[model samples]
Target: MNSATTTTTKSRALRRFALHATSTCATQAEAYGKCILATYTDVRKDACKEEFAKFGACLRESVRLPRK
Candidate 1:
C-alpha cells in the first residue's frame, strides 16, 4: 500500500481500538465524565485527578495485549 493508504488504515485501527477500550471501561469513563461535569464551573488542575486516574487505569487494562 501507498504511504497515504497505510496512514489512513493505521488511523482507523487506532480509532477502533480506542472505541473498544472506552466501551470496555464504560463505568470508569462515566465516573470521570460526571466528575468533570460537576466541577465544570470552577475546575482546578487536580479537581478530578482521582477519577481520571481510575479511568486511565481502566483504559490501560482494557487495551492491554494478551501474552503469547
Candidate 2:
C-alpha cells in the first residue's frame, strides 16, 4: 500500500480509538455516579465499593486506561 493510504488508515484508526475511549469513559463516569448515589441513599458502602471496583476494572481493561 502507498504511504498516503497507510497514513489515512492510521488516522482513521486513531479517530475510532478516540471515539471508543470517550464513550467508554463516559459510561464509566455514569456508572460511578449512580453507584455513589446508591451508596448515599440505599446500598451498603462496602457493597457499592465492591460493585464500583468490579465495574470500573472491567471498563478500564476494555479501553486500556488506568483506573482514575
* Per-residue accuracy of model 2 over 1-68 as CA lDDT, tens digit each: 66998999889868766665567556655676787876676656475676567556755576564569
Question: What's the CA error at residue 65 for candidate 2, in Å?
Answer: 19
Q: Compose the digit string of candidate 1's lDDT tens values, residues 1-68.
A: 56998999889879867885678788888998999999899998989999989988887776677789
Q: Considering summed lDDT, which 10 consecutive residues are worst modelled in model 1?
A: 58-67
Stretches of model 2 off by over 4 angstroms after superposition: 29-68
TM-score of each: 0.77, 0.37
Looking at model 1, the pairs that clash are none
Q: Global lDDT for candidate 2?
A: 0.67
Report the CA-based lDDT of candidate 1 relative to the real structure. 0.85
